[model samples]
Target: MTDQAHHETTAPASVLIVDDSRVSGRKLAKAVTALGHRTELVSGGTEALGILGEMPFDIVLLDIVMPEMDGYAVLIAMKADVALREIPVIVVSSLDDEIESVARSIELGAEDFLPKNFEPAILRARMNASLARKRFRDRELDYLRDIDTLTEAAQVIEGGAFHPTELNLASVAARDDPLGRLAKIFRSLAEEIYDRERRADLTVRTLRGTLLVIAAGSIFGIAPALGRLASAREIPPLGLAFWSAVVAAILCLSFSIGRSGLPRLKLRDLRFLTLWALLLGCLYQLLTVVIAAHVEASLIAMIGSSRGFMVFLLAALLALERPSLQRFSGLGLGFAAVAVVLLVQGTGEDNDLLWIACALVLPFLLSLHTLLMSWRPRHLGAATTVGIMMALSALFLLPFAVAQNALFLPSLSFGQRELITLALGASTAAALVLALDLVVTAGPVFSSQMAYSQTLAGIAWGMLLLGERLSPLAWGALVFVIAGFWLVKPKRAGDDFRITLRMKGNG
Candidate 1:
């Protein structure tokens, strides 16, 4: 290193001398300055505090007998201010007051006591020790701050929104220590992951996302038919919903455990989870199952097609979505389509208007569930979250099912009803997993297109599996619903999955 750089490396600490006697203060300043350190002389503790507030100093030499504010008062003020609390203070005292002053100074957070008529060697020794401690503390604080940066960087990466240059580890990486080595490695790995994601093939990603959408939609489309089948076998709606949720919870939870261990739940998360259970597990499922028995599956699916509209409506109401002409027009068309289905198709002999109106609640409940997902706990795997929600849903349904004596258990033969119920559960779990995958891979805008596939698949499955047919007006309504979905959908993914980090209460 150059001479200048070497000198900078061994630079002396900045010392502040506080004494009521100007002569004594100047003498102490001269002594400290002669020791290759910088010094500032203050006539009283108040002046010392003023300078300390204006700039940072490595140490303070305080006089016990000061006017207005004494050394003890200054020490109390410094200790109370978080910004100045860590700066070392060495109290200066006379022989007469040395014992009591040192004892009191130490009790008031002073680092050390120095005799006013001290030897040069003793002064040098005490000052050196205090400066060394200060330097070590400053280094430790820097290291911890850098550690926090690294932790935040990791969280950002896990949230699927990482960018290059987000991790601030350059200073930490410069040090010649194990921590520095770890910082270098971590930065390299994080940047590599970012580059890989940036360089990923767009066409490949799109294809994978499309496949997931179709698979999720096709699986979801069969749910109405499955519920219809279960209902036909005299299965009570609550029993079917409860059994299916239990099956899904078991499958999802087992997979989660095998992959990443059980999730850690805080009390704060229970509110979100319980509300989600109410919307999806109990209300939506019960309504769909009950309506499936009275209304045709195809018509039910068509009404369900208004889900995007409901989500958009709720998002706008919550101020989470911005208003736009195209989106508003799309919203209008969606409502018109729903109107056609209810007024034109529901009035037909095959479908009940009451059940059709009941099915409308399904999409509203779904929209609420979708909004709720935004506030889910951060850093949880897709399977883990879904597993917990399903499990919570089962817990919520258990008491209701027991009270009604409507619990449905499969026979030893594992017949068609059992098979259908298992299929329903498996399909729900698979669709949710695929949907989450698509959202992450291709973004929510692309994934929202699943509404189209779901509607078409539901109608197809109803015809093929249940021999249900749709009226001409119903088919037209489907077209309008698809168009409405296309219009209402945001051109760009607005906010991707929001990872909420909520702290638990003391309880």
Candidate 2:
């Protein structure tokens, strides 16, 4: 225990003397002070009450017969106030009025009665006993308060979401007692559980991130085919982009509102949101729609798959990620698979250098979008953030679509065009929201690994929906994507598979 606390527990008692007679008051003050206690003197009940109101005293020596507000009135008033009622009060009276005074004082809630000419020894015994009781009561109150704190700490443990410092048991743990020892043990256990929970959470988050990446990749893979179909109907790039963004915005906003309430955009977030919309909604969408019109869907997917490599390179250059040989090799293999699919499996116009160059730009924009999402405001939820971005994109595209006179509005009827349009918008909303979530739950590089799944899903969807064909060499290249995906996936902390493999070889 600290010296201050020890001193407080064993401190001298403060006694208040309230008497009409100045001589008797002074006498009692001298006697009390001589017993190593602190004493305050007041000539009447009103003055005594005023002094008591200002400060605390261990005991009060109140004279029965005071001029105004006698000791009985003072006792009744003190007992009425919860703050003063607990203080020990002793009423003083001379022999003549001792019986009546003592009976009335006890009825008025005084602790005991004292003779006006009481001996110093008797005064010491009575005052010392009262002081001891007051101190014991104080300690009991403190112990109960600490116990309540421990109960709160127990509830926090049961809640399963807390930091070690959040237990708030420092004061109780500081005491040199059995309860203090229990607090120390409980704190240590809480810390251990916190550490274990973190490790478990890390593993769960990694798995969830992987699932999000795959879901986003599969949804995004359908976009190229949709764009090609829209192109066949002579849809303008800006018109297609604008309509798709509007649909996505509507769907995302509804879900966001229902799930997390409407997004409140800050002035600082507007700049980031605007830029995000421009890249993903305006520029990227325009390029994607234009290239999808000319390029084969599978080849588009192959070129888009290079986004992972771009993100890896950019992240390394920006010092946002440490370059690892294992990760580099895995991404290299994925990139090589994309190259093989592009070069070995080609149809008419697939060899157009201009369209291919434009297609490659898609991955660079996607890489930048991935990194930007990582740096997004921490407060924005995935659905709300994506909803806001899509909404802004629709706003930005409206003027351009109008100026180009290429605004494509689907009919209210459930026609083929409307169905495709709805599908396109719904897929875009799901993909974008999940992508942002993956970025938050995992590192950007791991999130970018979705490119491998996107390539595979795109090719499969092309074959199933568009009657596209892939050669034997293209099929073999897909194996590389799968292998690379496994290599680049997140591992538990302190796990290094490459080192494990090397050690096994040496053994």
lDDT of 2 by residue, 144-172 (tens): 98999999988776654466677799998
- Stretches of candidate 1 off by over 4 Å are 1-212, 326-348, 437-449, 470-507
Estimate, for each residue in 295-404, the C-alpha lDDT of model 1 and write its tens digit.
77877777766776666666668865565778667656755765665565454586777788888887667666656665667777777777788888888888888889
Residue 205 in candidate 2, Cα distance off native in Å: 1.5
Q: How well does model 2 score by local distance difference test?
A: 0.81
TM-score of each candidate structure, all chains considered together: 0.55, 0.64
Residue 194 lDDT in model 2? 60
User: Model 1 residue 432 lDDT?
Assistant: 76
Report every candidate's CA lDDT: 0.75, 0.81
Segments in model 2 whose C-alpha atoms lie over 4 Å from true places: 1-11, 20-23, 148-168, 186-195, 221-235, 246-279, 290-399, 408-426, 436-507
lDDT score of residue 109 within candidate 1: 95
What C-alpha root-mean-square deviation, in Å, does candidate 2 show against the real structure?
9.7
Return the lDDT, model 2, position 171.
Answer: 96
